[model samples]
Target: MDLDAYVAAHAFEWQRLEALTKKRRLTGAEADELVERYQQVATHLSVVRTSAPDPSLVAHLSSLLSRARNRAAGGRTGTWRGVQLFFTDRFPAALYRLRWWWITTLVVNVVVTGVMIWWLLDHPLVEQSLLSPAEVDQLVNHDFEDYYSEYAASHFAAQVWVNNAWVAALCLALGILGFPIVYLLFTNMANVAILGSIMIRHDHGAHFWGLLLPHGLLELTAVFVAAGVGLKLFWSWVEPGELTRSQSIAREGRTAGTVALGLVAVLFVSGVIEAFVTPSGLPTWARVGIGILAEAVFFAYVFVLGRQAFHRGQTGDVDASLLEDRVATQA
Candidate 1:
């Protein structure tokens, strides 16, 4: 397709459009020229995309066209509609689209935790090396339960929210590096497995399950979601398929950002349950039931709303009209 020759033929028009777009003010003639140059470059972009499809050139043209369009339209600001669309469409679609990643993460972690607990239980020496008899007794009888009730419920909820949010944020932020997410998730599950093994060994299995299930179900699920999204970000660049690494990473990064924002609310709900429901005077059945219900509702939201948004062609990236068109087909 002689991509170089086509780019050379149209470079001047693109440069002229860029210059006009950056101008502080435009006379009527210059304004008309800006619009003319915009249209010409837009055509050049279309032809280049159809005939040559060079990644770098297409990205450059797309950026230039976006700026020109915005400059021509006088730019726009954020609005309530955008926020509403993010929750109702973008966020859910992202979760739904990436459901398998997180669901698989959840399953794998669960199995790992189960195996870890079983192994720990089989080796009393392992528990003894980690914690002395007094420490184990303190944890099994009082410390574990006391940890939840030591602080006021509201204060504890806030603390839990912040801590979990930070972990989730770390997953999304360090996801590009890949191994950090694995390390973080492993350490997390190891802690749970350690505590469960210790308590169950001391004939406190009922007490442990009662306290953990009410909040752990939804809380851990949120963590799994974050880890899953983070790994997906890592995979985007690793196996970008037809996309250039930058394009794939950029698209997934935006979707990851949406998931990060949505997880804040999810963690808050789990935090509230951890502080209030987990430590409340309610019986084991009710507390566990509340936790189960929250987890069920969360999955329903993802599968129902997210699936609808995905089917409607929402990929959780920012509006397509404002970005480069990467494919001929919608979504």
Candidate 2:
């Protein structure tokens, strides 16, 4: 393939790309020249990859191309348009791409919650071990029902949103450790299970489902999504596919951040449902129906808009200009 001869022929152009990459400030003409040489060197890298395929040369050109791509795209900008693009495109697309992770998380949580409920129901000892007879009675009768009305609707809604948002955030922040996510999910599911068991044991099974399903569907789903995305982020470092571990973690972590932010909106909706609809005078059917409708819309958003964005090559990562120029560790 005459690798050395080919390298010599185009060495000047490659050198120019390197020079432009390292230059702190570039003139307009030099900027144009940088782009030109970048493209030419990209072709050169392609030729070398196909003709000679030297590991060292390929890595060098790969890093150079990455830097050039970022430079040509320009650096990051903080503007309203960029903010608008992020929500409309990047956020949903990330959710769509990692839809499976969250969905699996939801399913597992539901199953775990159900199992906990079943175990408690079958074994009265477990329920009694967790709560006293009077305490359980109070929860099933007054405490559970009064919990909604005791707080002002607005305050309750805000509190619910904040609390659930915190849980989601914890999942993201601690997801890298793996154990924290599992512990958080287990603890959450167990609490719900205990409450459901208490209600059902006292012959208020219908009431339990009625209140829980009204907002619990979407609310729980958001939490699951958070945990799922967090787990995926951890897995990115565990098994990064073609990318280096650092590169994979960086990409997935950014995407996970998007999910964390998007989930705030989602949890807010669920909080509204829990505060207003669950305890309102609305008929059971209507209340549960609203919850179902909200959940459906979320699924549709992820599947429809998210799918389209993903197919168009959206990866939920920040724009290229906002990312590393050469997968280099930089601030």
Question: Candidate 2 residues 1-331, lDDT tens each?
Answer: 8888887888888888988888877788988888678767767777777778999999988888888777766522345766676767788899999989989999988998899899899999888788888898788888887887789999999999999999999999887877899999999999899889889988999888888898999998999989999899889888999999998998888998988888898999999999999999998899889989999999998888888889999979877644533332211
Model 2 clash pairs are none
For residue 285, what is the lDDT in candidate 1?
98
Q: Model 2 residue 232 lDDT?
A: 94
Off by over 4 Å in 2: 1-80, 327-331
TM-score of each: 0.78, 0.76
What 10-residue stretch in candidate 2 is worst by lDDT? 322-331
lDDT digits (tens) for residues 1-331 of candidate 1: 7988877877789889999999987788887887678767777777777787889988898889888878765532155766677788988999999999999999999999999999999999999899999999999989999999999999999999999999999999999999999999999999999999999999999999999999999999989999999999999999999999999999999889989999999999999999999999999999999999999999898999999999999987777545653333211
Per-residue lDDT value at 79 in model 1? 55
TM-score, prediction 1:
0.78
Evaluate model 2: give its TM-score: 0.76
Worst 10 residues of 1 by lDDT: 322-331
RMSD of each: 6.8, 6.9
